[model samples]
Target: MGYLICILLYIAGIIIYGIVMGKKKVKTSDDFVVAGRQLPFMILIGTLLASWCGGGGITGSASVVYLYGPVVGTLHFAGAPIGMLLLYFISSKVRSSTKITVPEVFAARYGDGASIIAVICIMLAYVGLCATQIKAAGNIISLITGMDANLATVLSAVGILLLTVSGGMISVAYTDAVSALLMVGGFLLAIPLLIGRAGGWSEAMAAIPAERLTGTGGLGVIAILGYMIPTISLLLGDQNMMQRFASAKSAEEAKKSNLGLFAAEITVCVLIILMCTIGIALFPSLDVPSNIIFSLAVNYLPFVLGAIVLVACVAFIVTTADSYLLSAATNVTYDVWGKYLNKNADDKQKIHFMRITILVLTVLAVVLTLFFPTILSLQMTAYTMYGAAITPALLFALFSKKVTKAGGIAGILTGGVVTVVWTMVLNSPYGIASAIVAVPAAVVVILLVSALTGFKGEETYRRLYENSKS
Candidate 1:
């Protein structure tokens, strides 16, 4: 009864916080989509942190770190820091530009058609990753509390859908900031307590598979690079990062925030690493490492501390689910619907479209989780697809003014075809990470195709290619 009360109280608090915070954001679509383009530094950091360090990082990577050890965790969690570092390189330009989305930037550079196509590709790839976050929420509630995973998953989805409908990006960011505060507070308290529970730090280090620490799984250097390449590429072009940059008050703030985000990511990674390591050390016999963080909390910690951790876990998942749903909705509403279906749609219609789209997406994500396998596989598949298909083309387009329209098309088609064909149909088997080969394959195809067809969208093929060089 005590544990149930703690849980209920927390659920109530977070929900109320989201609603109260989101109450002011319904004035316009711009406010909902981009936070009125004036999010302060702290809020931007909170939202970005909350979005990136979701169930995927807390549970998914925690599980990887616990089982596979630091090597995999680096690829999974630390890879995010790498991503933010890459973002800082272009943070100013991206933020200052009037473009609304990553694909919008592509549209600005190349053409509307190119941007629209990029949106289609990226949105499809992000579905699985977003679905898995919802799945993790359900899995944890069921596994730790002995509830029903399906029911919990459904409830979690409904909550996110409602949160999104209430405020869209405004609601999403506010909740993300709140979640971030809760996450840092909960994890900071729980890590030390968890380590102490595990018979101290030394004992925690002594736990886990020996090979998990070494970061090698019989895969040679080629195989290691193969695995990492996808993460590296995706970080370069992810919509989540783009949206955050777009939300910052200024270009300078965006760049500075990312720099701070990089530092914070390093610190947070260490904390999560410690948490996972402690879990592995203490709970060696646990059936599933993913549930180890909160399960350990509720089992050993008092109901009070346990509830904090539970709230933190829930916050982590909610923050991410809302952000992803928001981003995907943005892509569909602004990129697809606004651009193609209803070029003349007003601001009110746009907001309504986004609200309805998020509802549909939340439902779709819930259904996917019900039918899908583990969250880890779903996340990996989604990341791999986006990393290979969209990351490079977008990055090249960012600095390459001379990239011909024909070349852009070639790049997109080649990337999409190779990524889906190899990963989904053929299954990338070689030692090289699919991105390593796939990105280059895309570049070469785009270049050659543009040379032959002179298919530059707006700029001539030769001029675009030359501009890339200059």
Candidate 2:
């Protein structure tokens, strides 16, 4: 009952914070979408950290550590921080761009056709990503309160929707900042307690599977690369990351925020690895690996410590869900409705449309959660879908002058189609991830098509790629 009370308090606090911030900070569509372009360095870092380190980082990575051990798990998860480091190089350019959505970025460089394709891919990918968070939240709540999982899922989705619909980016970013702190603090407190309860570091090490202790965790290079590439690609082109960059006060703040984000990301990755490793040592055989972290918190730690960790985990999942939910809705508002359906939409109409889209997308995400069997599978699929479909074209637009509009459209279409075929139709043939095949295919197509078509958007390319240098 105490645990339930704590979780409820945390939820109530976040909802209240989101509502209050929404009323105070969110007035125009610009404010709702990008926080009036005034986010400071620390808040930028916090939002980035909390948004990226969602269900995938907490539950999905925990499952990997439980199965593969710490070494391989850490390597598998390293793609995110590595991607953040790579994004750091281009943070200034990303921030300098006036575009809000990834689709808008495509439209600026590749034309409207590419923008339409991008909206399709983003909606497909982000809905799934949002669903993963909902699924994780449901699992956490169910475990904490002994509630029915489906009912818990509905409640979790409601919480995300309420928070997201309240203030858009303003609510999402500020709540994300708070969640990031709680997430790190909880993990910091839980790690030592978990390891100590498992009979200390040495004894815990003794109990882990020998294969898990090895560098590869017996998964080998090909499999590890499969896991790593999609995350890297996703981060490189994630709409949530791009939106946060757009929210920063200036390019310099955006660049500096990347450094803070990298530090926070690495900290979370290491802490999760240690906690999951301890979980493996204590519970050598569990029916569900994803539940390892929650299991440790509920069954092993003391009441206070367990409640803190649980609240932190909930914060991670809830913040991520709302971030993606809001981001996907932004893609619709800016790229689809505002761009095509209602070119003359006022600030009031745009905000209303965005809020309505959020509610619709929330329903879509809840439906999607029923399709995937596990958080990891859904996570990889969503990551690969967005990464392959958008990242190749996006990175080319950002860095290359030779890319043609024809090439960009072809790349986005090919990447999205191939991912669907590979994962949904062929069932990820031979146990390989779609990213292993789809990303390279998209890149190759982009290069070949651009070479054939000749450059057409040189001026736009200069604006996006060269002018930002000034």
- Over 1-470, each residue of candidate 1 has an lDDT whose tens digit, in order, gives 45545655665666666576567556777788888888889888888888777887776667767766777666657577777788889777667566767777667655777787788777777666778788887876776667777997887787667766777677678668777777778778888788788778777777666777786633466655554666667777888888888888887898888887787777778888877777777777777677777777777687778788777787778778888888889999988899889999998899889888888888878777765566765676677777766776777676665567667766887787777777666766764455666777877876686678654444522222332110
* 1-470 per-residue lDDT for model 2 (tens digits): 67778877998898898889888988899999889999878889999999999988888878988999898898888999899999998777788877778888898889899999999999999999999999998998888778998898999999889989988888888888888888889888888888788889999999998999998998978889888999999999988998899899888888999999999999989888888989998899987788888899899998998889888888889899999988999999989899889999999999999999999999999999889999999999999999999999999988887899999999999899999999999998888889999999999999999889887667877655444421
Each candidate: RMSD to true structure? 3.8, 1.5
After superposition, the stretches of candidate 1 with alpha carbons farther than 4 Å from their true spots are: 1-14, 20-22, 217-223, 430-433, 447-470
- Once fitted onto the true fold, the runs of candidate 2 whose alpha carbons sit more than 4 angstroms away are 463-470
Candidate 1: pairs in clash:
226-433, 402-464, 402-465, 403-464, 404-456, 405-456, 405-457, 406-455, 406-456
**What lDDT does each candidate get?**
0.74, 0.89
> What's the lDDT of the predicted structure labeled candidate 2?
0.89
> What is the TM-score of each predicted model, taking all chains together?
0.90, 0.97
